[model samples]
Target: MDGQRDEGYVVVVNSEEQYSVWPQGRELPAGWRETGERGSRESCLAHIDEVWTDMRPLTLRREMADGTGR
Candidate 1:
């Protein structure tokens, strides 16, 4: 991210259900897309904290369920 305040921020999510904060209006990284969420980094982080209680990615969850997780 540019780290400049003018960039603002947005929340992003990937197929694995991971949540992250990214620079607003910036190009998104692979496998992650915008969630239509825009705000300060702190607010976005707080949203992630609240909604992303299960930090494990979807693959990990499937692995654990299949008894193949470490």
Candidate 2:
């Protein structure tokens, strides 16, 4: 493994809604949920780019909605 690329990947999301790519067969760390998108690393990264437009934390988003996150 050169670490430059991976053949199998899965898109994962955490409780905070952040996105990341994980190796396909590895166990996801706590707080992350697999989003059901599985493919190559590039595709998984592309999926994250497509969906994760807002980089704010989930707590921040909730607070902003309630007008308190300043």
Candidate 3:
């Protein structure tokens, strides 16, 4: 089988005072989606901050078994 994996980090800066790092295309934990859409940008940023904090660290990597790293 041939397949390709894309990996990267997402830095969400909803506002100046708050931000979050979403690794490997992973969505923020449950409830965060709702939080990001509600109220002010600051509030959304704060929600991201709270969700990402203390979560396990992540390392993104993509290697193709077929040797094409596509």
Candidate 4:
């Protein structure tokens, strides 16, 4: 794989509030949208790490909160 430092990336989030880094200037995958934060892959990952403190998906979190999840 190419060095991530050479490529640009953007922070993206889905309905589940999960965050990820997508290639800058590339079309985002279905159900994911850019968070308007763009930079080196490391920066994007840092952004996700800072914001995505909870690893669980939105639905699972909700279920847990409602006492429905395992």
The prediction achieving the highest TM-score against the true structure is 2
Writing each residue's lDDT as its tens digit, candidate 2 over 1-70 gives 6463566889999999999999887888999999999888898999899999999989999999999978
Tens-digit lDDT track of model 4 for 5-65: 5457889999999999988777888999999998888878888889999999999999999
Return the clash pairs for model 1, or none. none
Q: Over the full model, what C-alpha lDDT does candidate 2 score relative to the true structure?
A: 0.90
- Please identify model 1 stretches exceeding 4 Å from their true place: 1-3, 66-70
Better candidate number, 2 or 3, judged by lDDT: 2
Ranking by lDDT: 2, 1, 4, 3
TM-score of each: 0.81, 0.88, 0.27, 0.87
Model 4 misplacement above 4 A: 1-7
Per-residue alpha-carbon lDDT of candidate 1 for residues 1-70, written as tens digits (9 for 90 to 100): 4555843999999999999999887799889999887888888898898899898999999999999999
Select the stronger candidate by lDDT from 2 and 4.
Answer: 2
Model 1: ten consecutive residues of lowest lDDT: 1-10
Candidate 3: list runs displaced more than 4 Å. Answer: 1-37, 54-70
Clashes of each: 0, 0, 0, 0
TM-score result, candidate 1: 0.81
Best by lDDT: 2
